[model samples]
Each structure stands twice: as structure tokens, then as C-alpha cells.
Target: MNTQIQRNYEAAKQIYANLGIDTEKAIVKLKDIKISMHCWQGDDVRGFLNKDQDLTGGISVTGNYPGAARTPEELRQDLEKAYSLIPGKHKLNLHAIYADTDEKIDLDEIEPRHYEKWVQWAKKQGLGLDFNPTCFSHPKSDDGFTLSHPNKEIRDFWIEHCKRARKVGEYFGKETGQPCVTNVWIPDGFKDQPVDRLGPRERLQASLDEVFKEEINPAYNLDAIESKLFGIGSESYVVGSHEFYMGYGLTRNKLICLDAGHFHPTEVVSNKLSALSLFSEGMLLHVSRPVRWDSDHVVTMDDETLAIARELVVHNLISKTHIGLDFFDASINRVAAWVIGTRNMLKALLRAMLEPTESLKEAELRGDYTTRLALMEELKSYPFGAVWDYYCESSNVPVREDWLKEVKDYETNVLLKRD
Candidate 1:
């Protein structure tokens, strides 16, 4: 082994020791550390890799919005860059272009490049490619796609979009070593009342069925069919958290992707285990922080949120999930947003390994697992802000000057600290 790699092993071993994880199980589980490419350099994955930060050898290619290949050479160059960034022992997840909604929600303007060149280039680098097929065009879908729209024409348009995306995905799967990913986060739900009670659910099911029947089965592969949720929109446009419950229960796709930040400040309410319970099996988790009700805070997990988020992971409520680094803080410096986001996720995972005082079985038998485990939530008598502060203080992260002081003021003013 390289001397540098050996040093990293030693550092990780010490961390596991502090966390009370058995070294044997620690080594095995530590291998699961994964992060998204967006947090480092968007499409420019190679630019961020170095000996200083251990890139988990995993990458999730952002859809071609900001990082669209301006020319064929650019695409090839990006492919080469991504391949070079794959950590020696790990594989990169090259995602496909989803429809761009930041602008006017245009889909036709953003057509996917032919799979031919990508396959050829990825094959040369021994790279893997994943596809994200999205449909937000079509006038009928102006209100929503897949689920809410009642029109057949809109449904057909979405199906066609999936067909094109899946065709390219199938080619990539055949040529590249990685399976293709079909990711969709439809903005579909009713604001008022009355078009069709079951329109959203039926349309979503139909669209997925069409894709599975036509594209996935023919390819003789079952990669992941991830259903995403929410993009900033009118209140009329936003769907509640239950939408995920409906999507997961209705769809047959075994693996589910959960965007932790999409739940927004409500995630402050749902907690991590409650979020994981929506889907029994999880394939990917988009990790980021939300504040003041914004979806793209892109800030790292604060001390309080991390405490709650990790307890869920350690208990086996969620497993086999990749981190998406799902943040888009346009206000902050771009690189800074990503850097903070990635570091925060790493810290949250490490903090989560903090061993429990009681076994999971013991907690369950005593009925203290889900809601009770959220120490912040348990102190209802105290002011909400004060209870939140107490949880942050107890999380035990070393560096938290900005957050700690602000919450400390609230705790001192609001709650009477126990002697």
C-alpha cells in the first residue's frame, strides 16, 4: 500500500476508536464513505482531487445546465476529467442531464447530447455513466408533469422523453461498465381542487410503467429509477412531504432516492429517521442544509441537524445510500458553498458514528427510538430555540463559533439550564 493511503487508514482507525466502533467493522463500514461531484467542482471533477482531501472515489455528474458541453471537444474533455478523478479504488457515478428549471423551465432548449460520443469517450477512460431523464416541457405540463396533468398528450410527451433518455442510457450501460440511472423529480400536485382526484398518481405510475416496459426490460438491466421532489415554485406548485410517501408506495422500483434538504425547514420537523421511513429501501441520499425555508442552502449540517441525522444512519434505518450533495446556494461564493457542504456531510457521518449509550434493541424495547431520540424535540416545555441550542451544545463538534454563539444567546435568555 502507498504510504499516504496507510496514513489515512491510521487516521480513520483512530476516529473509529473514539466512536467506539470495532476496528474490523469500522474498516468495512468506513469504505462506504461517498460524496457527490457537485460539492467539489460540478463537472470539473478532476480539478478537485488531491492527497489532502480523500475523494470517496464516487461522483454524481450534474445535468448539463451550467456545465453543458459547449462543443464536442468540451464533452470529451469533461469525460476525461471525470475519469481521472475516480479515486484509485472507487467508481465514479456519471449522471445524465435533467431538465433545467432555474430559468423558465425549458426542456426542448436542453436536449441531451448523443450517447455515441459519451460512450466512446467513457469506454476509453474505463469510466461509468448514469442517465437522468426528465420532462418538464410540454405546455400541458406547465402546471405539473407525470402526476398532476390530466391530458394524455402531456403524458405521452413525458413517456417520449423517457424513451429518448433510456435509449441513450441503454447504450451507455452496454458500452460503459456502470448501470444507467433514470432519475425524475416531478413537480406534480394540486394547488386548488378538482381536475381529477387520481390524476397525479395515475399519470406518474403510467409514465414509469411505460419506461420500465419499453426501455429498462429490453436492455436486460435494472439500474436505479429515482423519483425526486420539489424545485422552487409557487405555493400552488409545491407538494407536501406526503408526496414522497405516495411516490415510493405506488412505484415498484426497489431503490429510492431521498433529497434531505428538499424537505426544507420541515426537515427540522420530520427528522432523519422519519424521512428514511418513507421508503424501506434507499439507493441515494441528497445531503444539504436548508434555512429560512430555502431548498439550496448548501450549507453543511449544523451541529444540531447532524446529531439527529446520524442517529438515523447508525440505527440501520437507512443503508446503501450515496450522498448527492444536493445544494444550490446561489448567494454564497460558488466554490465556498460546495466546500462547506461537502465538509459538513463528512463531519455529520463521522459524528453519527458516535456510539450509542444503549443498543438499538434496548432503545426500541423501551420505546425511545424515533421521536424520543431527537433530544431537541423532547424538551417541549423549553422554548423551541433554547431546546434547539441544547441539542447543538451536546453534539460535541469542535468548531462551531458562529452557530454556537447565536444559539447560546437564545439558550441563556430562553431556557433555564439544569444545574
Candidate 2:
């Protein structure tokens, strides 16, 4: 093994030891699927397809290359290149609304170009594209939507933009075989005092309704609409923040997406499960770990907090969902960053697979918060390294007695056997 591989193995072994896990059996519980920077290894993504050691069926791409293309042809070429890099099983995470340029461009001009390129690209490649659209300010949202300013011009401009994007989405679904994704990770609410942007919630809700009604169709749907509670940098967030919670509560569309790191750490808020509770709603799940519960997206499998989050995914609390390996690294080599990230994510997934099934379902329906929390605590105590020692000790992994009884009690008394 290379130095890094050796180092990782040793580190994992040490973690297992510290957690009182048996090194041999612990390795058996590890297996998962992933795609990452290595998915685009060496910029020759096609080269690594079905060849790289990591898991398969997961890869995402920004629209074409890095810089904005001036024409439809340039966009088409970028799409083609992105397609070439994608595997047959993977979907392309297209950046429909770029942070800088997308906010500025006229929807009328940009939508046609996007539509033409997406249609042609699908024809040539036989694959559908997923969208990542932004909904926030630049020069246009200066006064805010219906929420902040209620200015006719700003809201009208956004209305036009949403209409154009929805048209493009409809065209994409009709021509290509992919569903339209309404990615509204908007930073609309403020962190501090808001002198000018009061009653922002009304504007936001009105805008959402208008956009949905005008742009979206009964059949033309959203695969996953993201709902971020907060944001970093100059961008603000809706949903989780105090100013936005009421608005977020009111705006309940199906198939909402939640970032794992978005919630306050060590809390069982079940942001993923909460999204599912919305009548007939589904979710697109984004998994990333926060350092100190901030946006330090260095997700690792070894993190216990992440393991708890993993329990949610494996138990199928939220189904019909797509996954995003959400990570941003400015300091490391891009390839290395993805490799490390992919590895960590896969490990978490594998551990989740080992999670006990029916009991989890039971916990969900019981409405007993205490029982559910205890069950999660038990699930977390699976004896990462030493099964024997784990059993001998006060660990959660059932050994001598029927551990199923404990699981049953929690399910029956607490959750009332919903499973």
C-alpha cells in the first residue's frame, strides 16, 4: 500500500480499537457505492469508468467546463464533454443557474440556449440531465422577492426567470428522458437586523406559488427541491433560521432535499424524516459532515454523528431520493479530495446497511421521542471492533440474551409497532 493507504488503514484500525471494536469482523460491515473526483479521475472520466477501485453508479458534473459558454454551440460542447465523462449509470448534476453569471443573464436568452443544448446532448448521449438552479439575489434581488421588497420589478424579473427555466425544464423532459429538478437553495433571510427586508416571508411564498403554478406542470415535476435552513458567505438561508421557519413550515412541497449538515449538531431533528412526513412528499438527500456543526464539509465515515445520520438512510425513512456527495475543498488536489470523500461516504453507507430494519420502522411510528432516541443510541453501540468484548461489555450489539427483545420493547411500547 502507498503511504496514504497505509495511513488510512492504520487510522481506521486505531479508531476501531478505541471504540472497542474487533478489527477482523468490523471490516466485514464495510461496503458501499460512490462516485467522486476519482469519477473524473485525471480529467479523463471515461478512462476511469468501470476501472477505478471505488463504488459505481454515482457521479455529478457542473454544466460543461468551468467558465461560462457564450453560445449554444459552446454550451453543447460543454454538455458533450460532461456526458463523455459520465458513466451509463450516473446522472449529470448540471449547474443550470451558476452563482455569478446565471443570476445576471436574461432568462429569455439563456433558456433557449440551455434548452437547445440539453435536447441535442440527450439525443447524442441517450441520458437525462438534472438541474441545480439558484434562487437568491445579485443585482436583481437587491430589494428581495415578495418577501423583502415587494417591488414589482424585482418580483417580475424573478417571475420571468422562473417561467423561462420551467419552460426549459419542460422541454428537457419532453425531448430528453429526465425529470426537471427545482433546486431552490436560496439565501433569502438575513442573519442580523433587516431594516428594508421585512415581510420577506409573504413575498417568498407568493413567488413560490407563482413559480410553481406558472412554470411547473402536473406532469412536469420536481424530482428534488432543496430546502436549506441556513447559508454561508454573503448568501442567506430560509427554512431553519428563526425569521424563515414559519415560511418554511408553510412551504411544503413533495420531494424536498435536506442537507445532513444543515441542522444543529447532536440534535435528533430528523430533517430527512421531517421532509418525508409532508403528505405524499419525497426527498433528495445530501450528505456532508460539519466541523463544529458549521459548513466544514469534510464528511468522514469515522464520525459518530454521521453514523447516526446514516441510520436514517439505511432504514429507508426517506425513499425515492437521489444522493449528492456534497463537498467543497479549496486547499487540496481535487482528485485527492474526492477520493477521500468518496471513501468516507462509502464506509458510512456500509455501516448503515448493517442497521436493524423492522425495529427502526417501528420506532418511526411510535411518536415516543424517548424510545426512538434510545433505539438510536443502541444502534450506535454496534461494537465497531471487538464483537466479543462488545458483547461482554455494556454495548448495544445483542450477544447472550435475545437483543431482539430490547428492540421489540422499544418498538412495541414506544413506537407501537408501526413496522
Candidate 3:
């Protein structure tokens, strides 16, 4: 530990002490919160199916940056490097397509054994694993639909795939001793206006029912459904709109996934957390920075992200929320992208934890709006960076801007060497 960092942290602690907040307790609490980091960013959403498939599902990864992981081993290596720099024990979010086998395993035929390597890896790292059913980037999803496809055969294929994915998720949960959140997100929409939207939604609901027919123990696995407003090719209409999934999640007792970029440009996902937590069993958050559209850019310490952390802390919904990152930016260093996004997320959570919640609530309850606003504004200038630096130091990860040197060294010695 650097002496300078400890000195700064102690000073910051005293400042927080004056506000009736314990900085030490905040750091300890932050350590317990684990953010699920997505695996797709390392490979630009290109899984090791070896089928020469193009990305579908109204999703696309722009920029042909060098050194994208071409194999499961490389991806895991990059993830390990990234995780070593991030504080706290975290979870890895995997898609069904990231199976570590060389065999031509069809999506419908995938089994838990296919992901045994990932289970073993997570076990070694003492990390939990979450899962997703890849309903896109395959021949079956060429029509910009899967679960809601007009063809029963295609829909059945997707249903079977989701069933297998749930089983895999259960296996992960059992192995890691944490509930695996199995999320379902499909790109079932139309580029042009669809006259029969209700038909597709009905089919989708039926498909979901069939997929989730088998009951898995809540201890092992939980189900979640994600909705998207618009995508690259599905700008005209999205079948699985927010209203559709919100209703389904409430009625079916499933976790509703709220992607930061899945709603309108003006819609704040942070604002919806409390409202949804009131009815839904739980919720999955896909944290990403969207540039105008649903472009999965790396997250930063932006207002929206900070607001999300604030909501989770203020509402005490951290336990009920399954936090996960969902972004794929191939333009920069892939490992650096993971470190930046994950660190920013942790920082936001830390900032929220260091808030003077008790005082703020007391002021609010007493109808002291002026003091509430003043305290809120004053908190913006707190020595959050000092606390964050202390956190990185105590967690044994690189502190502040110092972590960049390690990334640069890795890029030179490892990434740049890749053809």
C-alpha cells in the first residue's frame, strides 16, 4: 500500500465522519457487491461456433480493432487479465454460443457439460456465472426473429435452445453456490411496419411458456426476460417491446431485464428501478453507454450510470438486482474496455455507498427541500477519488490512473503480438 494513498484516505475518512457516514463501512459494503462482467466484449460478440456466421439480431459491432480474441482460451485469458485489475470478486456473464468446445454443437443440442470448462474456471476463480440464450447470429435467426418467428419450426428450435440454456444456468448456480440469472433476449422485430404485431407477441409468449415449462429450483437458477425498443435493422417495430416484457415478467414471476440502452433516448433506466422492484421478483440491469441508439459502447462515469447506482443504494435494491455489463466496443483495447467499464461501475456504486443517506432521508421527511438540495450538491465535491484509490489499494488492484500502465504493457507484450 502506498503511504500517500493511506494518508489521503484517512483524511477523506475524517471528512465523511463529520457527515455521520463511516467510510470504512462503505468500503466493506462495496467489496460485497459483485458486478457480472459480460464475456462478449472480448470477441466482439463473435462466439466460437466455427460456423462462419455473421452477426444478426439487429446487433452489430463496429470498428475492426486489432487483437480481438479469436478463441475461448484467448477470451478467458483476456478476462483474467481484466479481472485482476478490478476490485471485488465478480461474476462472468456467458452466452450459450461461447461454449469452449470445438465440436459443431447446435444451439438446441447444447448441454451443461459444454460449459463445464467455464464452471471449472469460475470455481477456480471463486466467481459466479450468469447465462444468456443466443437467439441470434445463426442461420435460424436470419429473418430477424427467433422466439417470435412465424415459422413454428424456428420458434421451437429457439425454445429448445432456451431450455438447454436454463439447464446450463442451473448447473452454474449449483457449482458456484449463487443463483444463475438466465436471461432471454431476442431480436424479433420488423424493419418495416408490421400489421400483425399481436400475433408475434402471442407466439412469443407461448414459446416462452413452453421454454420455461420445466421448473428449476430458485436456488440454482432464475429466469429473466429482456426487451429492446429498437435495433440496427428493427427500427420500424420491435416485437419484444418494454411493455411486453414488463407485463410478462410481472405475471410470470420472472426477473425483468432493463438495459440502459434498451429504451428511448430520454428514458432513464435508474428511474424505473424502484417502480419495477415494487412488483417484480427481481431485476437484471444491463449497464451500457448508448450513443444516440442502442450502440453498445463502453460505460463511463456518466450521470445516468451514477443515477443508477444511487437508486440501487437508496432503495436498498442491490440484493434484488443482478448487475451485469452489456457492451461491445471493438475500437479500443478489449481488455482495457473491460477494465474501464467495470471500474467505472464499481466507482459509481462506491460513490452511492459513500452518500449521507440517513441525513438526506431525514431532511426529505422533514420537508427541508433546501437542505436536501444543498447536501446533495455538496456531496458532489466530496473526496470520492481518495476513497476509490483506497478501495483499489485495499483490494490489491492497481490504484487510479496507475492501472493504465499495466494495460499498456499488456497491449504491447500480449495483444499487439496477435495477428
Which candidate has the highest TM-score of all?
Answer: 3
| lDDT, candidate 3, 208-257, per-residue tens | 99999999999999999999998878999998999999999999999999
CA-only RMSD, every prediction: 12.9, 15.2, 0.9
**Any residue pairs clashing in model 3, and if so which?**
none
Global lDDT scores for all candidate models: 0.45, 0.45, 0.93
Q: Evaluate model 3: give its TM-score.
A: 0.99
**TM-score, candidate number 2:** 0.57
Q: How do the residues 1-419 of candidate 1 rate in per-residue lDDT, one tens digit apiece?
A: 33543454456556546535444453244345545434123323322112122211111223322333333354344433432322222223443332212333233233334445555655776555555554333354555545335677766766666666666666666666555544554556544544554546655666666655663652323334443333533233343234544465335644455555555454442254455555544555555555544344564567544654465555554344545555544343333344455546554554454344345446668897683466334322222222122222333321234433433443344222311
lDDT of 1 at 365: 80
lDDT of 2 by residue, 1-419 (tens): 23543454456556655545445453333312212221222222222111222211112222232233333344344434433322222334444443123234443234645446445655676655455443342445433222234576766666666656666666666666556554544545454455654466667656656666653562544634454444543234342243253234335554565566666566433433544545435555556656645353545765543654464555454244555556544333333334345445544554554454445667677777677777668657653323232322222223323433543443345323222
Give TM-scores for every candidate, taking all chains together and pairing residue i with residue i.
Answer: 0.59, 0.57, 0.99
Clashing residue pairs in all predictions, respectively, total 2, 11, 0
* Clash-forming residue pairs, model 1: 147-200, 185-228
Off by over 4 Å in 3: none
